[model samples]
Target: MPDVLQQRAGVSVLVCDVAGPPVATTETALDLIGNASFGGAEVVALPAGRLDPSFFTLGTRFAGEVMQKFVNYRLRLVVVGDISAHLAASGALRALVAESNRHDHVWFVPDLAALDARLAASR
Candidate 1:
């Protein structure tokens, strides 16, 4: 399946396929942003599985770089999936997730339903 444009809580979202190529670099992240922009989506919903393992390792700074790209483009990035294992391994990552969730630019949610709830609350 390909990435899809969806509307959740009256917000346009580009929902990426789980089987899509891993977003391992900033350039890859830009591609996603471009797709979302082309689709007129305000948000990009990327499954956590699609993210490279380095994204979960805070020291690698992969997460920061990719997320910064989204922020620079003024697009919201919603990482959807269970990241318990990653959270368990790094306190810094855990804190970053916590901090990111507190804002509107980036979020890490366990499922689409959670993302919907968050979108609903934001509006």
Candidate 2:
């Protein structure tokens, strides 16, 4: 899959389609943010595969640190694609997704269609 920057619901977004844990640290997150900012993207949609598995591990600070970079830059982030298997293994991650979805900065969704809907609704 190819990574691309796109516009959805009048919002600029960078959609990453790379396979397997592409983003694992704050630096990686910042890199994405920088690219998105340069492209005038207010939101960045990353495939689940691009994220390290440890990101879903609640005990680790990986998710928080990575997400913090987005928040600090005021960029909206969407972790796109399915994460049912991960959620099933950890109640904390499930809760986190539920709560994060209630806000505008970060979101976890099941697919591209769902992400499009979310962007639409926000507008």
- Candidate 1 per-residue lDDT, tens place, 1-123, comes to 999999999999999999998999999999899989998999999999999999999889999999999999999999999999999999999999999999999999999999999999999
Q: How many clashing residue pairs, candidate 2? A: 1
Q: Candidate 1 local accuracy as lDDT?
A: 0.96
Query: Model 2 — which ten-residue stretch has the worst lDDT?
Result: 17-26
Model 2 over residues 49-106: C-alpha lDDT tens digits?
Answer: 8898999997998998888889999998899888999999999999999999999989
Q: Model 1, stretches more than 4 Å misplaced?
A: none
lDDT of 2 at 113: 91
- After superposition, the stretches of candidate 2 with alpha carbons farther than 4 Å from their true spots are none
Which pairs, if any, clash in model 2? Answer: 22-50
